[model samples]
Target: MGQREIRACWFGAGVLVGAMAASLCAMRAMARARADVSADLSPEVSPEVSPAALPVEDAARAPSAAPESGADMFEYRGFVVHLFWQALAPARYKAWCDIWEAGAVVQEAGGPPATYPTAAEARMAGGAWARHWIQNNG
Candidate 1:
């Protein structure tokens, strides 16, 4: 095989490995989350946390999706950053981010060519990418 072909083979293999690793991590995280949720909702729950004792806001508020593992909101200095994955063909994902300052989106970063095998991997890498951008540009 020529040099370019060999390089492409290695790159493809690396992507596969990365995706598999991310899938395993995501599965583990999901399992742990399910266990925790089940424990909280168990029939033997404590009195203070019973369903009837839960509080609701007097005013309606817009609902927001809970951040996934590895994509939770993080802050540095005065900026807030959150990572996400952009789906690409053939089950690949690209890392992306929304960076906020003063309660508004200040930047959006990353995407294309499906650099990651899973959303978890994308988010993890995206977080680093965002931090790097913040360090140099923010």
Candidate 2:
């Protein structure tokens, strides 16, 4: 191949590598943020929580916290999605929140409000939802 062709090929390769690196970095950041949510969910789902705050007894329950104030809050800071079994009598549900930084929670409560499912499931769903927000927004 000629020198010109070789240089062009090298340039293209560089661009591809740069893009891949950026994507990997973003993925790492997102993973870290999701991890924060998981960590925060731990204390929020304990059995000794206030009954007034939780309002539910089953591990499958979801949170009843209201939505975030700003649209940007949901887009940037993340959100809380209440996953209920049914509309009227949601016995057990899951609460999913998305945090921004590695340990930054998007909720006013500093974590997801309250979840009804086992701590594992609540954390899983919350992390999944947070990752979804990051992926979709970016």
Best by lDDT: 1
Global lDDT of model 1: 0.61
Q: Pick the TM-score winner.
A: 1
TM-score, every prediction: 0.42, 0.32
The 10-residue segment with the lowest total lDDT in model 1: 58-67
**In order, what lDDT does every prediction score?**
0.61, 0.44
Per-residue CA lDDT of candidate 2, range 34-77, in tens?
Answer: 55434545455753553366645533333223221111123334
60-104: candidate 1 lDDT, tens digit per residue: 121212223444578986898766564453346677777878755
Candidate 2 wrongly placed segments (more than 4 Å): 42-138
